[model samples]
Target: MRIGELSRQTGTSTRSLRYYEQRGLITAHRDHNGYRRYDHDVIHVVKNLRRLLGAGLSIDDIHQFGTCVRALDLDATPCASALEVYEQRLRTLDTKIDTLNHLRANLAEHTKDLRQRLRAK
Candidate 1:
């Protein structure tokens, strides 16, 4: 199918598809008329890409493990690299959560102090 059809089917913007192509996250072939053509399975790939992005995976991270995911979907083959990537992302998320919790605690303390001062006034 053509780029427009892919975008419509995937509910993704044409610009984002182009960006994905440029970023090498997705591949397309150019027809003789210079139109971008994609395989039908690209819809699944795009959906997976969007899901990964929504999960906070960067384009670089996706590039690292995307082929593994595609193989798993298309051939029922599993790749160990995907596990490594997931583990790394989990660790990163855990660290971020710890930092955010600390910040929230500090913010709560400051808010309590402000509330006490307001009560005194």
Candidate 2:
């Protein structure tokens, strides 16, 4: 199908599809008229890409394991690189949570001290 059809079918913008092509996430062939043409199976690939993006995976992270995902066989066999990406993202989130918790505790203590000072005055 053409780019417009793919975009409509995937509910993705043509610009995003172009960006995906530039990022090596998707491939398209140029017709004689210079229109971008994609295979019908690319719809599945785009859906998977959207799912990964919604999960907070960056383009680079997706690219790392996109080949396995684009294979469309993940339902039967999960990719090892995909597992690694998930693990990395989880660790990053854990670190951010820890930092935020520490900040919250510090802020609570400061607020408590300021309240006591105000009461004394």
Candidate 3:
């Protein structure tokens, strides 16, 4: 199908599709008129790409998926490399969450102190 059709079907913008092609995440053939031609299976690919992006995986991290990128929808587990990337990203997120929680606790303590002082005044 054409770029516009793919965008409509996938609910993704044509710009994103082109970016996917430019980023080596997906491919398209150019017709004689210079219009992009995508295969039917591109729908699945686009969905998988969106899923990965939603999962907080960067485009570079998605490249580590290898063939698993195409198999994201399969019932089978992803390849080990993809699993490794997922694990790493999880650790990173956990660390950030922990840091945020610590900051929030400090902020809350400061607010409580200010409120108590204000009440005394």
TM-score of every model versus the real structure: 0.84, 0.91, 0.92
- Model 2 agreement with the true structure over 1-121: per-residue lDDT tens digits: 9999999999999999999999888899999999999999999899888888989999989988947868665666679999999999999999999999999999999999999999999
Model 2: runs farther than 4 Å from truth?
Answer: none
lDDT of 1 by residue, 45-83 (tens): 898888778888888888888576455263366667767
What value does the lDDT take at residue 24 in candidate 3? 92
The lDDT of each candidate is: 0.85, 0.90, 0.90
lDDT of 3: 0.90
What is the Å distance of residue 43 in model 2 from its true position?
0.5
Better of 1 and 2 by lDDT: 2
Kindly report which residue pairs in candidate 3 clash with one another.
none
Poorly placed runs, candidate 3 (over 4 Å): none
TM-score of 1: 0.84
